[model samples]
Target: MIPAGSGGRNRPIEHASFYAALPLIDDFERLSDTANFTALPEDWLIGVSDIEGSTAEIAKGRYKAVNMVGAAVISAQMNAMDGQPFPFVFGGDGATFAIWPEQARAAADAMRAVQRWALDEYGITLRAALVPVRDIRAAGLRIAVARYRVSDGVDYAMFHGGGASWAEQALKDGIYGFDPAPSGVRPDLTGLSCRWAPQSARNDMILSLVVVPVPGASARLYAQVAAEIVTLAQTLDRGGHPVPRDGPAMQWPPEGVALEARAQRRSGTLLRQRAGILFQTFMAWLLTRTGWTVGGFDARRYNRAVAGNSDFRKWDDGLKMTLDCDNETSKRIEALLAHYHDRGILRYGLHRQDSAIMTCIVPSIMRNDHIHFVDGAAGGYTAAATAMKVQG
Candidate 1:
């Protein structure tokens, strides 16, 4: 059982709607402001999941599969929680989420199910850990959360303090880790899809970035750096959104059809699932090509929402973004980061590619609020994170 408090600190009053109760900040730049964050209840648990050896997987050109597995963690947990609002952030190689202790069993089942599914479907190992917020506090780190409203109907969680990063390290170091479920366990990955084709960079390049303050660096310094970087990115077209306003182009056979088939294969055989996916995608492609609305489903409107709902920028203990920009803009952003790196203020990594990909969790296409996670096509956050480690 997880403790309610640690180190003589009083347990926080439990708010059933703790996450929903926090005010939403509309401005992305304001994320750097620590004042906007709320301390999570000590009894809440932080769950971290990541693809083991994700960097090597990216080198093998399996980035799409890598991304699919990461997004699966969120989709499974959300389905398990029955859409009750909670907070989660999607990293290209994995994801992190927080949950109340009451939901621990469901969250754990979902995590184990995803771990097994990833291995069974794609030969990938997903490492997961559920660490208590009290444990994080005991380690002298904090878990502060803020909600950033991306659109009228969608808000992504932004994490502050180093607890999240610490949880990931602990998972990697074999602490607080758990084993995958027995064979044949399947996560309820309803609505997880990767049907859209990769969006080619409209500008000269698609840049993937990871910027984190060095250990013991003051929060004020990190916030100033983050704000400056956000400002620089804002100067780009559509704020460096890789997807076009109309959404990504739809090819007849999407590059992710097979992966989506695997995700949808809960009850049906793989062959049946693949065939169904093929037929459905065929209709979607035709509708998108013809610009038609059938059964109250507008392909154009859905596509527009896809563009607007993409998680192209977010903060998770640090700043992470996938931007489409010209060469000069990329150079300028890097130079600024290099100046800070030279001064030992931070550590950063960047990867440039020609296009970006979107992995989605669409509960309902008619809802106009489905979310899409974006990452650089060749090597997104996983590669950038590896580069950051290499610089040390």
Candidate 2:
């Protein structure tokens, strides 16, 4: 969610103007409709960040930390821009975003800060890069973007044209990238947190899926496949939202308390940050458990907002989703994906787990617009991606 007043009103009109001018698409299914996406300006830059060995980290039961660091990239850039509007998509282990030329320096600095923080705090190496849209075009690709409004004051970006995927590949190939800052450096991870316990799957399984068209596949075929999957998911409750209607269960001394403390450590000593987070979360746990409202913060309303504003599904040059469904529905999705995979129309990956995890950026608890990112508690997109690579 773009923070209010951070729409670049004080900057040059050209800065982030393209994303700001586009009309928000209310239906998630329309994300597959090519008519809704607008080509991004050639001068804009795409920033990508990911942990170097995310799969290994997840295997070590550190998926929460991996998700936190991935979301930190978006958080840092948002804070750096002072909450200005931009288009970004959060992958389970990484994130991709676009910014105009005027914000490149700030974006780069923020990226560097996150890189350092990830290494120092979690011993994870974060790879980051900034690729120009013109360079993407030079490589025979384009970046097209559309905003999908998930709730009031909350919109998640849907990407098409494959530019984001190419930029990520370029980053991995050691092109157009930068190194991490020295030890002790940290980004402004002001609102990043993973407070709620993992949401157990009510439907027997939490399925993480990623589907992408092959290099020569027709766009029509890909869109048809994506639309069909979206339709299939719609048959389930709340389109397969993993979190319950009231929200995921809250626990005292949250699972990610240490991570949350690290995120806020810039404000004071680590111990102090940890203590502060503990106090705040304890209060939240007590309030949510008792269904109480205190001075603009309605526990029940905020919980519902958390579930409503989550990013369970998104398009980033391809379709990705974390769904809660029974084994039968999961089989139907796999069958559909397999039918197309055999014909070379698309390739896909699916991973199943008992629960899903959420990482949030709450600019203010009193505001219902806070955004949450969801992924399967076990491996999520990183494992799905690995499985996809094996398909080839």
Clashes of 2: 1
| Native-to-model Cα distance after best TM-score fit, residue 315 in candidate 1, in Å | 0.4
Global fold similarity of model 1 (TM-score): 0.95
Evaluated with TM-score, which candidate comes out highest? 2
Q: What is the lDDT of candidate 1?
A: 0.88
The residue-by-residue lDDT of candidate 2 on 1-392, one tens digit each, is: 48446356466786656677889899999989888999998888999987898989988999999999999999998898876789999998999999998899989999999999999889999999999999999989878999999889699988899899999999998987889977777799888988989999999899999999888888998899999999999989999988898888888889898889888887568889888889999888888888887886878788888988999999988999999988888999999999999999999999999999999998889877689999999999999999999987
lDDT for residue 52 in candidate 1, whole number 0-100: 90
Distance from true position, residue 51, model 1, in Å?
1.0
- Lowest lDDT block of 10, candidate 2: 1-10
Q: State each candidate's clash count.
A: 0, 1
Query: Could you tell me every candidate's TM-score relative to the true structure?
Result: 0.95, 0.98
